[model samples]
Target: MFTEARLYSPVTRTGDGDVTVHLSEEHPGVRDPEYRARRNAIAALALEYVPGAALPRIDYTEDEQRVWRTVSVELARKHRRYACTDILDAAARLALPTARIPQLDEVSAALAPLTGFRYVPAAGLVPLREFFGSFAERTFHSTQYIRHHSAPLYTPEPDAVHEIVGHATQLACPRFAAVYETAGAAVARLRTDAALKFLADVFWFSMEFGVVRERGEIRCYGAGLLSSYGEIEEFRGAELRPLDVRAMGTATYDITHYQPVLYCAESVTHLEDVVGEFFATIDDETPARMRARPVSPRPAAAARPRGSA
Candidate 1:
């Protein structure tokens, strides 16, 4: 359930417009079979909008808005403890004038000055290659949908909570944004599917669920970890290691539970340096045949489940 302070009313748009939906914990049930089916359908549609593909505009009802807000607030509350003050400060600075769902055109206009990226309305899940490809081109593919308030913690394939609030605000920061671009290009240049998979795993661990040491304290920077209320305590007390690219092949990580271990970078520049080195190493190799092979759509088989129980 969501707190009243976090529950927001849905805003509507007409004539092929997009809106953010905030869900209430009690209303707009999350267990409805129809809702799940619709979401799955959307996920399928999202997959179709892979690299070089454009997504179609979509509409949302008031119910959807409530769901989005519920999840967004839950994520914000959960990660508040581990959040980087600097990143949060930047987010606060870039906060929209209103709490209403942002129109795609409006989002694009706001981000135009900072980066060439534009918000593309999507409904389905995107493949990893396409996902990284979007970042490589500075085009951030975002979903126009929101989760139900009743299921604030539920994972909706690609919801607005994860894309907009979790990642977009960070994208507005120059250093962070550059990391995304550089990482994307490296993924593209890697000549083997296995290498790409290894890199993706590194990204999954660090970017999506990573933590960092700041001023003698560990803080959350990975959006996936920062957006979940359940993860804050786990990550803070979890074992952390310095990121080692050479050891990535033998490295294993927890993906299901709140991460119990994390890899740290002394600084953003160090993180960037490591990625640059990995990219250079891969580029020096004889282009592997696997490079042209498509990445798997399913989650990595070796990915450690949550909790490791």
Candidate 2:
């Protein structure tokens, strides 16, 4: 249910190779004809793509570039205060441009030497299996369109900012890349939908919105948090539990709002160890087995009622 807002988007391709990106009524770009046309044009590039061919370069307009610049400068500030050392180091190495949105090819080029990861285009929502499974090949599916310029700091879906500024920076680190590959390999082995969903939920908790403690402060490593100017400012105040696979897989969250409950790792090493082992060992029966047992009781502090201040 949480992914309805965070992951899913309406994209339909016609038999004649035309692609239409259906924006939600509430979407910032929904009422703008120019933005809608721009989305359709960008989506067409992905539909016409040939594997191993050069990625289509988007000529982002001045307004789009301004949105990218605004979000980049603001997020950089939040990242310095809230992001974990692992991601901070990787971002520094990637050195993404702040004045303009980087093309997928540029991102892929920057990543080739660091971790052998590269980017591929996605018109819209990539199927769960194909999206995660591509990690094994060290390829990431990225959307090329920027969010509507009207809301530079907000987006209801994963745009280029989320794909590149959020994920590409993390992929610059080998440890994160290895974990992603391990998860992709695990997805390939999972048979039942329940098992696949279980792994996805665990990933949602870890790579998408997970946090860890370092030097006595809770730091965010999750891309969802790192890319959000508002969410990054508030995540440290959420209910934080120690890392637990069962808890993570079974937890309920709403992506339309700030997450109320979050899991924490003792450190980056702890996060990698627990998440990596889970991906490495999880199978079709893993979810059933984990769900059969009860999650441990929540700590008193974590059980306190959560809400915006």
Best model number under TM-score: 2
Q: Against the true structure, candidate 2 has what lDDT?
A: 0.86
Per-residue error (Å), model 1, residue 158: 4.1
How do the residues 1-309 of candidate 2 rate in per-residue lDDT, one tens digit apiece? 336334646888888877789898878899999999999999999877899898999999999999999999999998999888999999999999998899999999999999999999998888788888999899999999988988888888888888998899889989888989999999889888788888888988899888999999999988888788778888888888889998888877667677778899998788789998999999999988998997667543332322211
Per-prediction count of colliding residue pairs? 19, 0
Predictions in order: lDDT: 0.57, 0.86
Model 1 TM-score? 0.71
Q: What is the TM-score of each candidate against the true structure?
A: 0.71, 0.94
lDDT of 1 by residue, 180-249 (tens): 7776787677656666666666666666666666778888777666555455546766666676654432
Which residue runs does candidate 2 get wrong by more than 4 Å? 1-6, 297-309
Error of 2 at 87 (Å): 0.9
Candidate 1 RMSD computed on C-alpha atoms after optimal superposition onto the true structure: 9.4
